[model samples]
Target: MLKEDLKTVNEVSKLTGISVRTLHYYDEIGLLLPAELTESGYRLYDKGNLLKLEQILFLKEMGFELKQIKVILEDPHYDMQKALRKQREILRLKSERLHAIMALIDEKLEGDEYMNFKAFDMKEIERAQEEFKEEVEERWGQTDAYKESAHRTSRYKKEDWQNIMESMNDIFKALACHIGEDVSCKEVQDLIEAWRAHITKYFYECTPEILSGLGDMYVMDERFTNNINQYGEGLAQFMDDAIKYYCLNRL
Candidate 1:
């Protein structure tokens, strides 16, 4: 490890503030492997390996599972810069949420009579949702469903959008409460049917094919998954499975 561009595993651990044991575990799991091993069997990481490690850490911080991160990083067409930009946007949204919560806390401390600490402003949440929608459109705008959704939503007023978001959140909360129910059960199916109708009413006519694709996105897209899982643990995957069942059996 005489090379200036190479770092020993211990040095990398110290520099990254990650425990050596964890790094070893990552290596063992094939998530991150050392660039080389010295004659004395010391693990070494080069500059490229360090950059990959940075990406792994960033994704981990963003709540991605280790296996998911590995799949994303190993994809042949993975866009590093795009991923970083998305991560930055996620951090920005989190910062905004934290700021809003802190402001409510401060208002409570100051005895402000108007303070509503029990809930967040739906407007802010809707704004973040709109931003994410725009991002999705930018990435998938060539698809017919994306174009249809954009056209359908083009005339919606702010208040209309707010109502739509509120309705969606309500549905999510209801579904979260029924998490343990079978996806094909009548109650869950009714809720999912209503969800489908809601999407068609607000965005576009969501056909079974389009709805199925959205279900896959719910599980595959981190931003969407995070939003859904906010209602409850495993809620995103649950929603995905329900959507798939609805599309297959009910459609």
Candidate 2:
């Protein structure tokens, strides 16, 4: 690559409008890394890095959290063609929504007596987007890492599984009690650390990267959200935020 092909971190920030701190956070979580670092520790992103960042941003726009995007991008099965196809479907749904709203407005301008609120219904759009995201997640879940987790857990008897569930529930219950507190505080971060450790001990490696993905899953995956929220209202979201802060700043 030519020297001119590289752009500094600051230049990337200005061009992409992503904060410098966020870029650093992404680097920390193993989501995105600079193509090269100068002798003095300056980050320089090449075309490949920028292209990867584009994939990340595109997934982010589709409402997938940063951690989910990381997994999707890191998976060996990831294909830019597949991403483009997903983006095309999302955009088409959006365009249809816009056209529907426009037609409704035109009807109103023509003095229609009935008001149709169906144009604003988001259920179909949300359902399709969720399905698309799940498609990506399903593929990623079949990777060797997940298979490892499964293989390890499959050996456990019912009581062992019960113990694991109880242990995990205890963590959620404790986190629920601290729901109203600042998630970034040391107390909360310590809990986040324990949570990561627990997963590593019981299931898989649970590296900072994978832990971040679990954090997003707590909120994005309805099963997790529902189960976690049962401990306390909004507990899942609080844990998600705390986990993110812990991953970005602590780990």
Candidate 3:
């Protein structure tokens, strides 16, 4: 029947890069079940199932609840095109945030143009800061560290933050070089200590746990990993492991 051209659970797992457990959970929750089951009880999915999975992944990444996601997916009136358009808008916001970060780096490389006679049409930096602060707060809740980071724009001059950003970038470059060679060396350890000291200056009451947590986030979160690994491959994972090791040893 439906199993004629469908793939087995193991085959689907390999093809989709989704774990077997997650697939089973989705089936149990009636989120994205296989199209058919063979006599031996092997789950089999068809091409249509793959399309549904793509939709499921898209909605999940956008932070939709499973119940809401199922309703939306099942609704014949639900327009995938419209949903994608909304996702584009969300991506635009994320792109603006990345642009702001790049602008800070650019300001470090190039002289400040704001002080010149040329007038700009908008306050891009302030807009970016507000949007970023709101998004981070909404997602992670307002932690003391995040609050401190938000108020940073007011406390320190733009030039100062630019300098810090450049310094941090340079440090990551150094770390990436070490990772390419050997991560468990004494040199890497010393550099990590310096990095820790640098971080402690801005973040309030920085602890080993917090530092290590950020390192893990660096690799786990695509944005952070992409930024850090711009210089080298696997650098983000190297940093995570190094930081975790340092935290366990030092703390």
Candidate 4:
């Protein structure tokens, strides 16, 4: 019995540019299955199945995990209009993040020529944080760390900045002597405390969670990783471990 909306698996694959194996897998997973099977056991998709497949591919391209998408699509209360609006909102957020990253890249390329580029020091960090306080407040809401950071930063001095850089280098030198030793040792912990004290001058109000996140950023951010690595080979990893240990236990 021929159906008006029916398409054989081969025809559907050709039309959608999806492989036959993938279609079979989707059928096996119950993500998308054919409405009918022929006398020869050939899979045949209907118009509704094709539409569902199209929606799945669209969601996939938009970064939706398969399980989340399945829940979204299968929900009795699912509204296509609402789903599209949510997707648009998320894409907007991604666009804004991308723009900010591009601006940072441009600042790096321009270096000293950047109009608002402040030298990376305790004073500049304080000033910049103050400038962005409203935005940060909006994101994190009222928190002790945020309030404390604002208070701590107001007292940051130029001499403090120079001491921080010196102390950081001194700590790195000490750690280099015992490269493979436990980073959580008392000696390393003290060095981390000194480093943390310096950071507190700029970002005193940050929570333990935020501190840990910054430790991850030290290695994840290529620019920061490069700076530490330039001190010595494997220095970046060592510094990452030290920071992680500090944030985990002592920060």
Global Cα lDDT for candidate 4: 0.60
How far is 117's C-alpha from truth in model 3 (Å)?
52
lDDT of 4 by residue, 1-251 (tens): 23766898899999999999989867654467566667897888876677678768856765555544443453323344544565556556556656665777777797745554322224433343343333323433354554564445345454553354566677666766656778888887776666566565555534556556656655664434544554566666776687778876774
TM-score for candidate 4, residues paired by index: 0.39
Score candidate 3 by lDDT: 0.65
Model 1 lDDT tens row, 71-189: 45533234567777876776677777778889888887898878465456456545654664465345554555555665655556545655776788889989998887889988888
Please give the range of 10 consecutive residues that has the lowest summed lDDT in model 2. 70-79
Candidate 1's clash total is 0
lDDT string, candidate 3, 168-243, tens digits: 7778788878866566688888778878887767534567766776786676655446546655788889888888
Tens-digit lDDT string for candidate 2 (145-224): 66666566546654564566567777877888899999998888888888888877876687777777777867765544
- Give the runs in model 3 whose Cα sits over 4 Å from its true position: 1-142
Identify the candidate with maximal TM-score. Answer: 2
Better of 1 and 4 by TM-score: 1
- Note the Cα lDDT for every prediction shown: 0.72, 0.76, 0.65, 0.60
Whose lDDT is greatest here?
2
- Which residue pairs collide in model 2, if any? none
